[model samples]
Target: MKPLNLAQFHLLIIAILLPVFSMARPGLAQIPKEASQIIDDVVVTAEKRKQMLKEVPVSITVIDDLEIQDRNVRDVKDIFNLVPNLSVSSQNQNVTYVGCRGVSPSMINRRNPFVMYVDGVPFSKISGYSADFTNVESVELLRGPQGTLYGKNAMGGVMNITTKAPSNDLEGRVSLDISEYETYLFNANVSGPIKKNTLFFGLWASEYQTRGYMENDHPDQDYYDDRNILNVRGRLRWVPSEQLEINLLSGKEIRQGGDGPMIGDSQIRFHEYKNPDDYVDADSFDNALHARFHAKKFDIVSTTTYRNATEDYDVDYSYGSSSVSHGILDYENTTFSHELRLQSPDDRDGIAWIAGGYFEYDQDKDNEMSMQYLPTAMMNFNRKTDWPCTTTGKTAAVFAQTSIPFFNAFKFTIGARYEIVNKEMNYHRTTTNLDTNTVVSSAAYTIEDDWDSFTPKASLDYRISDNIMTYVSVSQGYLAGGFNNTIDDPDATTYDPQTSTSYEWGAKTSWLNNRLSCNLSIFYMDIKDMQVTEYPSAYVMVASNAGKAHSYGGELEVKFRPVTGLILSTGLGLVQGEYDEYMGYGGEAYAGNKLKNTPEYSINAAIQYRHPSGIYTGLDVQGYGKTYFNESNQDNSVRDPYAVVNLKLGLELSHWDFYVYAKNLFDEEYYTSIFTSSIRNSYMVGSPRTIGANIVFRF
Candidate 1:
């Protein structure tokens, strides 16, 4: 498939949204009104309380169900392109790098700066963050440091997702998607009151399978990266009284797929894996109990959550004309968390305040994080080492925030969180000569560490009329220090603590009776002891501190409805960062290199038109600016800016919805990741163009 040029891309977008305006079918007489004439108001719980999006003094984007449906947002990964400044680099179906602003974790580090919360259950672990968007109500993205309220590892941002609740009316829907590459998806959901207004139940389930994109030429004809997954989510709600409600939520995901990432050379190549153990199997389970009691003046909310995730990976580790393909790297993660909070009523007249306490514990049952397939800074060839380890951690925190109204239209807010963390690890390692059946070295040991931090935030906002608002804020971000996945360094020096202070100013405005809206924000942050990867020797790689560093950026989002049936939307995010002072492993100074895995800019633009005859058409473009895969800023580590286009056409009726989409319409050539390791470079190719159709029936 040939890719479209820059000029054709723009013209295609124009054609998709404009052609429908010339038609006025006879069925127009039955159409009530143009749905796009008025923009809908959004409500969000960004600060742990119900509030209007325009009233919150934070930089946030809320993806409502309408937008999600129109954009074909199948899973969490699809959201990265809808929000400005949010980016993701996927090495495969299981390994992905996610970040926001300019703060991201080292490529090899297990700790992350971004965190996600689903129905009060937190998923902060890098390997435990995959889920399908089933029965979802909304997705809220907080763009900057959220350490003050989100508890842990939210230095960069937070993704707070809420699922739809059961209603009194019996309702259900079923959908099936058929696409290229022999892909098939089946989804179904049902929800209704089990007993009038006292009890309700909701359940959603989906199964997906596909013959992956990577070409395989092995005699076995087994393709690489093929995927098969099943996901099921259920919820039960009980309302004992007008003031008391409780909900129980549970979800499970099971996946059996081909080997991990498709590792290719500087150019593309057909893969041939003869290893018998080359496959990936994974499963995740989540359970949570949430309760709320509302009084005349205050509300009490409590949530208890438990999760278990496990994965077994065995891949043919072949890259750049070499192969070391055998054995297994498996891991299991178990977590438990509890949160209790008290907040003022949403309609209370006095000052609003909230206070909460959170506690969590996690355990890594078994795995080999230290002995991986990475071509470290010191080797032209890869070596096989065996290091299996178990790690355990605990975190406790108390937080409070208040909103005080003054001067008629001005509001002042202040919030803070104090947190304590402790962790321990035990591991055993054995290094053997590749050509000999002899063990060159062996060791065993146990290590423990602890750290504490305080993050605070302050902001003031003023309503400059009924439809316009402006605000200024200052906040701090913190990430507790941890240990490296290496036996060489077992102390706190291996994982330095990171902290940052940021300042921001922003405005939100709506004009012409909601026909147009614009939001903008500018921010600058200063960071200390940034955690990054360091190659100490050609044979050893570990995590270390990169001294003083800073970043500044701006964002703009706009929406306009020129005609009653047409809408146009676009957003842009610009971010830049450089190290102020840093010394590499061998005394090589890296004082001005860009941050790894952080894009310079991100953009999302879309246009949509719905005719009176039930015809719906949409065109969207998602793009990212030049990005570096590593901190070196070398030629082999960077990729130029590129954009991908998607098209959607659908029909809507009282009980049916139908659509066909072409994703990556031009079959654009792009790689999700490009890194220079050892003597050559390896690439993780992105998805190719896909053409598919969906059918839905609602009752």
Candidate 2:
């Protein structure tokens, strides 16, 4: 593959930044002489404490509810380019992967580099983190190792999602949307107080359906890629007295769709799943209980959660019409978690601190089959496998951070988390071989394993002035090891845990009298015992500890409101990631290859204007550099650089909103995924141009 061209890259950067400069000139000239609008300071809970975003000594991004609506961000993947140095991709609906600063998930079942939390309860299970947003309040993306506050599986970073809480006053909203590709969506929400200052409740629900994007010409194939999703959530809050409060949250999700089919290498155009029957159906339920007790000096909080999910799917696998049925999968998973924390009162002036402990229990049961038929020989072989696994984890940690101020200008903060986690897994696998209707052979085996680890963090901050602050930090991250359940090979049964150390320096500042805000950060991470996935056989995947790897990058974010109701925002991410030393299972040398699914650079620019007369318009553009799809770094397995644009026009009035939107306005052609397996090589194309309109009413 050709190396990145410097001249072309420079030109693209100029093109992206030109609009920002050109648009600002006119806004500046028209600024009102008496304009005195002071932008409000953002509040965040990044360090497990309520503090101003600018005061936190971490690289972070905060997307509020207003931004969520303006950007039409309905899911986690929709915010990929909105933030700097972050990416989320999926091989299929059941196997989503997230990355930040070039550090990505190496194996499907291995612990994620980053962790996501909903309403203060962690959702480490891969299946549980991709739910739709129903009543979201805000989303916070904290960069660098978060091991000090959130333990293992947070090597890359953390995503905290907060949902809207119940209010004392009654309120309700209804929304409907229609789009191209035969799509329809509906949303409803209601909240009110059962007893003033004593009890409250909130409920939300949404339904979405689509005829799908791809066209299937094969007479036997009914559908190729379609979508249907449903989400419902409820929340209850109780305040019996001034010193104590209780919260209960529950949700359910149901989804049915056809997984995107791989476009074969020989095919000139896309759109077909050759298998006779190919589809997926899955459902899940979640519940969380949280309580807080207030005291004069400190506060105590506890949370408990339970979740259950099931998934089943049939795949063409062969990517050709040569086979009627290739594979089928059935799986079930459950998780239970508990956490307790003690936090110092926020009113304290001398010092602040928090301490916590956590525990989780999880289980998985699955059965799969692969079939082959030789019509000429009048023979058929079916290999069916069943695996059941159970895991329990216990974590005890004492974390405390103290801040000491000098001359009321500089702050020195030191924090450390001494964590000990013990995880044990009990697994069993059985396989049977069948021909025609008879079983030829059967085998079964059981295996057990355990793992443990520790992580720590530290940082310092200097308030350069009221509008600017600079900080430096260093931290260690950890991820637990687990047995692989995809295959029966002994070597693939277990892999070692992965770990990393990160160093970061950054600055946050507000300029032009708080009308413009800019943040910059540079980070470097060194990882050891890096876990990498390998496909040794056509249908089998395993994880192993490859050699070391390193990632270094810088991110910049800017937001400006040059005039009242006029906003401009831009973000740029530049990353360089490579394997310091590595080799694949078959002795394939790849010591200097780039990481998979990680773009070298990304750019996002957007502008929006809102008139006092309740009218608004916006334009958004995003660009991504080349992304490799495999460890081999082959030219065929890459997504070349591409850009897409979106437009939004809306009208707002008291208790009502109407909007028209279009995505991929330029109709850019790109690939969402590229798969090159021993059985077949295929690609999943991105969604095409789409237009839609939405209406909402409030009472």
lDDT of each: 0.79, 0.74
How well does model 1 score by local distance difference test?
A: 0.79
Stretches of candidate 1 off by over 4 Å are: 1-34, 268-277, 320-322, 325-327, 368-384, 433-437, 491-493, 536-539
Q: Against the hidden reference, what TM-scores do the models get?
A: 0.91, 0.90
Residues 336-428 of candidate 2: C-alpha lDDT, one tens digit per residue = 788888988766776787877777766665644344332333334555544544555565566666666777777777766666656555555
Give candidate 2 regions above 4 Å deviation.
1-37, 108-110, 266-270, 367-398, 420-431, 437-443, 487-492
> Which ten residues in a row are the worst by lDDT in model 2?
26-35
Clashing pairs in 2: none
Q: What lDDT is reached at residue 333 by model 1?
A: 91
Model 2 lDDT at residue 100:
82
